[model samples]
Target: MSATEHATCLAIAAARAAADKKAEHLAAIDVSERLGLTDVFLLASGANDRHVHAIVDAVDEAMHRAGAKRRTREGFADAHWVLVDYGDVVVHVLQNEDREFYSLERLWKDCPAIELPADLAHGGSRDGDSLGGRETTAS
Candidate 1:
C-alpha cells in the first residue's frame, strides 16, 4: 500500500508551511504499509525552540487551511519535538539536535518517499530521504 491522495496533499501543504517558517530539513515518508495509524509522516527541523514553534504554528495553520482537522498536537510546551497529528498525516516539527538524535527516517527506512514540491525541499540531504525503494507522487 501507499499513502493516499488526501494524505499526500496534506503532507505537501504542511511541508510548504514548514519551509515558509525556515525549517532546516524537510521530508515526507509514506508509512502506509508500515503503520496503520497514519499514511504519511511529514518531518521537519528547526534551528531552535522558537523556530520549532513557528514551524508548528505554520504547519497547523496550513493543515487547517487544507481542511485537515488535527487530532492532537504534542510536545508544544518544550518545543523540542512537536508532533501535529491529523488522522491521515502526522507532522513532526523538531529542534535540529533532537531531529538528528532521533533520526526517525532510519527507523522507517523501508517506507517510500512522498514526492514533495521543489520549493519545499531545503537543508542538506540525508541518506534517509531516498532510502525508500520508491517515490510516490501526489497532486
Candidate 2:
C-alpha cells in the first residue's frame, strides 16, 4: 500500500517530537513500497521508563495536532517499549535497554531508512549530524 504525503509528513512530525524528547537511536523507515500495513516506521529509544512515556506523549500530542489519530498503543504502563499505531504509520518508542535487546533496526535492516528534512533531522536546526535517519519516497 502507498501512503500519501500528508501521512508521511505527520510521521515526520512525530519522529521530530520523539527526538526533541531526547530519544536515542531515532530513525524512520519508509516501508510503503514494500509493506502492506503502513508507510513509515518511526523508531526511537528513551533512557528509562519515564522518558519513554514522555516521548510517546510528545509524539502522540504532535500527531494529534496534525490530525492523525492513533489506532492502538501498547506497553505504556511498563514503558520498556511503547508502540503507537497511527494507521498510516507505526511509532515504536522504546527504553534504551529494551531497544538494545530488541534491535528492531536489525530486524528491518532490509528496509531503507527514512531521511528527514535537514531542519527536522536536527530538531528545527541544521547543526547536528544525521541521526541514522533514512527514507525512500515513492518510485
Candidate 3:
C-alpha cells in the first residue's frame, strides 16, 4: 500500500528534471493505496505552453535515463497540461493557470507526499545553478 522503492526513485528523478526546467510548485504524492495503475503522481506547474512542454520533455528524458519507460502521454499538442504515464510514476506538467484550476494537491490531499531533497526543492542543485528561472514566494 505504499510506493515501491523504484517508483519513488523515478518520481524523484522526474521531480528534479521538472525543477531544472523551472517548473513551479513541484509535488509528488504516493497514490499507491488509492490507485491501482500508478504508485506515485508527480505534479509540476509551468508558466505557459512552452514551459509546460519543456518541463514534460525534461521529466520524460530524466525518467527514461533512469530506466523507466513512458507508457503514454496526453495533452501534448495543446500544452495546457501534459500527463506522462511511466507505469509506476505518472507525471503531470501543467500550465500555471491549469494547475491552480485543477488543484490536484487538494484533490489528493490524503495521499502522503514524497520528500524531495532540500537543494532540489529550493531550486539549488549540485551544479550551483538555480533550477527554476523564476521563484514563487509563498503567500
- Using lDDT as the measure, the top candidate is 1
Candidate lDDT (C-alpha), each? 0.82, 0.75, 0.80
Q: What is the lDDT of residue 116 in candidate 2?
A: 63
**Deviating ranges (above 4 Å) for candidate 2:** 1-3, 118-139
**For model 1, how does the per-residue alpha-carbon lDDT over 17-60 read when each residue is reduced to its tens digit?**
98898886687899999899999999888888988999999999
Residue range 15-109, candidate 3, lDDT tens digits: 88988987777777889999999999988888899888888989988988999998999999999989999999999888767876777877887
Quote the positional error of residue 38 for candidate 3 in Å: 0.5
lDDT of 1 at 55: 92
Candidate 2 per-residue lDDT, tens place, 1-139, comes to: 4566876787789977877887666677777877888888888777789989999999999999989998999999999989999988899987766766776776677776766654444221122323322322222
Candidate 1, poorest ten consecutive residues by summed lDDT: 130-139
| lDDT of residue 4 for candidate 2 | 67
TM-score of 1: 0.89
In model 3, what is the error at residue 123, expressed in angstroms? 7.4
lDDT of 1: 0.82
**Model 3 deviation from native, Cα RMSD in Å:** 6.5
